[model samples]
Target chain A: MSELVHPLHRFIRPSVKYSTFCPGCGDGTVTQAILRAIDGLGMNLDDFVFVSGIGCAAWIPSPFFNADVLHTTHGRPIAFAFGIKMGLPDKKVMVVSGDGDLVAIGGNHLIQNARRNIEMVVLCINNGIYGMTGGQAAPTTPMGIRTTTTPYGTVENIFNISRLVMAAGASFVACWTAAHPKQLTNSIKKAIQKKGFAFIEVFSQCPIQFGRKTGVGSAVQMLEDYKKRSISPKEAAKLSEEELKDRIVVGELVDLEKPEMLEEVKKMKNKARGEVE
Target chain B: MNGKRVQTGRYFMMGNVACAEGALAAGCEFSAGYPITPATEVANRLAERLPQVGGAFFQMEDEISAIAAVVGASWAGKKSMTVTSGPGISLMLENIGFAIGVETPCVIVNVQRGAPTTGMPTVGVQGDMVQAKRGSHGDYEIIALCPSSPQEMFDHTVIAFNYAERYRTPVFILSDAFVGHMREEVVIPEPEKIKTEYRKIPEPGTDPQKIKGFLDEDVAPMPIFGRGFKAHVTSSCHDEYGKRNLIDISALDNFIRKLSNKILKHKEEITLIERDYEGAEIVLVSYGAVARAAAMAAAQGRKEGIPVGTLRLITVWPFPGEEIEKMARGAKHVIVLENNLGQIYPYIKAEAAHDAEVSFLPPRLVGEIQDPEDILRKIREVSK
Candidate 1:
């Protein structure tokens, strides 16, 4: 065996697992935050599983995570991860996919899993574009962005994932950004700690693609844009949709408590045995 | 006196329906699937039957979730199964790997319709015999059974469940569209015996309860999900404790080798290949429904002084290598037959009849069901 072990790079595993991310990519920041949160949640790396779908952000976990990471066929990480988690619920199952992956091709699974509260966590990189597939407009793409599919700027409305997830009956729901590392990490940590379904939509940066097309270059400048263009749920409650034009929303939208599914399964088994739930 | 006769021993049934009944009798509590051609009857019948037995059944929107839901129900401590045809089987490949990795016990019934892609849906075909083994993207062993009749469907479906439960592996029952759709005499057992080797439960009151997913010994330890046990389980390269380990070469290699060997070494107990030998010089090898046609051909050939014999493979996987070699001794000619273009002929060529002459006669559909005339004609051609 080679005797060289780089001590500095060794601590950054899920970090160094990705060598292809663009400099200052928000995906990389969120990726590291996820790994750090895994470290803090007392989860065994051996029981941690990650799944992804098509998109630059989806590619982040394909070869990057040191876990059983699978970059599956486009637009179905939730379905695949649903398999992994349902087949082995004791595992710390999570999915890192893109907005198009969750909302476009796999939208059916997103809401159904949340509605049933399947025991898995889904983290969406809401970069508002299908970056890896040549920057077509995505479901989360804002109304006026100039995309390859929308050269004249989009006419479709954007998706507020937090509101969507809340309406879908997710047990826990939150929103975070790469700009808020500690908060994002904590959100991920809490999501992992939850027993039922957890959904966290991260406003990730796509500097080389979505950002460049929208003239939102300079990683720091895009974040400044995020701060300026984004509004919180509380503020949004007071302001009109017209007032929120050119702005993205932030903050936890819903975090209600409900009975996790597997607990009900346990109760059924007990009931079968004539034991009181 | 009334001259009416009683058909006591058997009742006519569809192959897929029999397989469904077999699963139900064997205590299957969960049925999840999206219906496809040649397999819709099984799904439809189970939808009504499972509820009467106080079990659960759901019609998933597609095949992927159908298999996934069955896998989930299996982990939730229920015996589960799914029924589908070729197109649906293609979508189910991903979770099949997860089942192998996690050693989740479940049954997947494939009522094959013709196709490279949707060829002959309402007709019979045996095209998926190879895909049942290789379509899934991992390296693992499978226990596949092909039933020649509705009676065999009932018998083998129970066997599939038994083997799946005993070893915690995915077991497949391969039936073709003809067999799935054709109604035939099948005696419904008064009550079907469904059996699985249940995993051992965790002892109560530990701060962290331990439910073993994969065992150190060849026998996998039992695990009951949500029984208040805290087990670390995963579908990745895992240790005995079920932790996801990526590059641990020793652990992974040992697991792959052992899991294959643990069942394979006892091939005698698991393999169920039937043979007919009375100093026969010509042997006809067949499986699934074609075996019946081959058997009829062989019997007629024997009457005609051709000295023909038949080998019926009940356990399609583990391929009964030792038994085939034993039966092939002193045989002058062996003919392999199947629905596809000789999918399993190469195995016999590679292992069984390396020294003897081996010929593969590809019959394209259930319309002929492996023509006795075709085998007889091939036998004469080979003899000359």
Candidate 2:
């Protein structure tokens, strides 16, 4: 009896010190949201798997979470997670990452997975700037924003993650802000329950680098801005194109209708062998 | 070096093909990889054998996926591996780093070729020796085994898988293009005597899987899918409960430091070296095909009365330091012969210190074997 209980207490790990995130940073909130989501969903502790690339948000899962986590080289978790999922489809898999990990270094995998609709959930922690790499401008840094990498100002346009994932044909694509805890948690739950590739883009805040440079307010103020700047998903679609030019759309935008990647592969296999129509 | 019966199989094949056969006989159930030279035969052979044995074979998009797939398959309760060479190895560094970081069990075969960058694709070079130890951009330890003849290719590969599953970390059979392409007599491991282990996934399709990977210890139970438990995997540094923590210093510290310490703690079980110390004034240190030549040279030296012994490092990384150090400190001189220029000599000298006079024989001899007479002469020169 004692032996069985002894093993039960294992798997608890500590995390990294001096988070690259600033106080009131939404990435911290997003990280907690994911852990809480895992706790809430009652997913298998041993079977829980997470993978991330190099970034502030990417490090979120690195030092913590005792599940089968892999702190990979930058921007390749999607490729890494693809193997984990396909190799062991019984496990509930997730990829915790930032704009650079998901949209930049790992963008190819993101688009491909969306297109294939592999059975997994992608929690894209899109904190506006590259927080870990000393506030470099990422592909998600909005137009004209100044970052360490872009001192004058970023000339590149930002990638609206959910919109892109939806366009790429993910089976499920949802957007929420880290500040909106209830919505974020709800979307996470839905994503956990979804069969196909469920993509949830959480617009998080990095008040340290991008915020200090642009003279933005505290982490809390950034959350308020997140609340005000983004229109609800339902209303934005109903609004005119001009009304949405500066507005970010936040909601479940794509609830797709298609088979998951595994099923499709199986179908392909059966077809190749002429076992089924 | 031990006189175990080397049962020669009745099959004409390449070194890599025998390696795959050895893997199958040892009960390898899955292979995930993208094919590259010298190493491609292992992948090709698995592609044929896996289906026949009710196993699985997947040609991953690239080396990264191949290793990752093997890691995942291992977690799903299968013995797994991947094979590649040169450039593909550069890509494998990240996940290989992950395997070390997380302590997952699997085999990775790198058929070494000449390369600072594609130096020689189809050619042989042991140049990747240092890179094998320091490749993954971290301070973790590595376990690399080099095989010279086709027989060692089969034997060492089987041994590589065993070591991997035993330690639950990546073990490499660092074959060169020569060892891979050359055909020779190899004793395939009998299915009964060959040892194997699979990941500890949950029972088939039952309850919610609820154990943390790498929680209390350096190792964790594997969580395979369809075995009745839902698993969550991450690339992040995690806790004992396997939950991703955002800022746990101790967790990160323990997880990272445990890498070197774990291998060190099990040094006896992990390290392999063949030493012919005898009454020798000089020693020839080498591995893989080069070691074979060094052995012949040492034998020839004895016949000529210039007492020479050979030390073969089977486990290249986390090198057989303790033994080599003792032997070198007592030797009159040492010579390091390799296919590449001076890569491994520095390591031997570093271990032996200023005690042993050292000499190096490089790859310039190319296609031809190192002249035993020349190496013996160098040994005599160093001793004098």
Best TM-score among the predictions, by candidate number: 2
Tell me the deviation in Å of residue A21 in model 1.
13
State in Å the error of residue B288, model 2. 0.5
Please give the TM-score for the first chain of candidate 2.
Answer: 0.89
TM-score of each: 0.73, 0.79
- DockQ by candidate, in order: 0.12, 0.19
Q: Model 2, residue A5: displacement in angstroms?
A: 25
lDDT of 2 by residue, A114-229 (tens): 88788888888887777876888888888888788888989987787788888888988988887777778878888887889999988887777766777776677888888888
Q: What's the TM-score of chain A alone for every prediction? A: 0.89, 0.89
User: What TM-score does candidate 2 reach?
Assistant: 0.79
Task: Give model 2's docking category.
Answer: incorrect
**How much is the lDDT of residue A80 in candidate 2?**
67
Summarize candidate 1's per-residue lDDT along B8-40 as a digit string, tens digits.
246678887788778876778787888689899
Q: After superposition, how far is residue B321 of candidate 2 from its true place, in Å?
A: 2.9
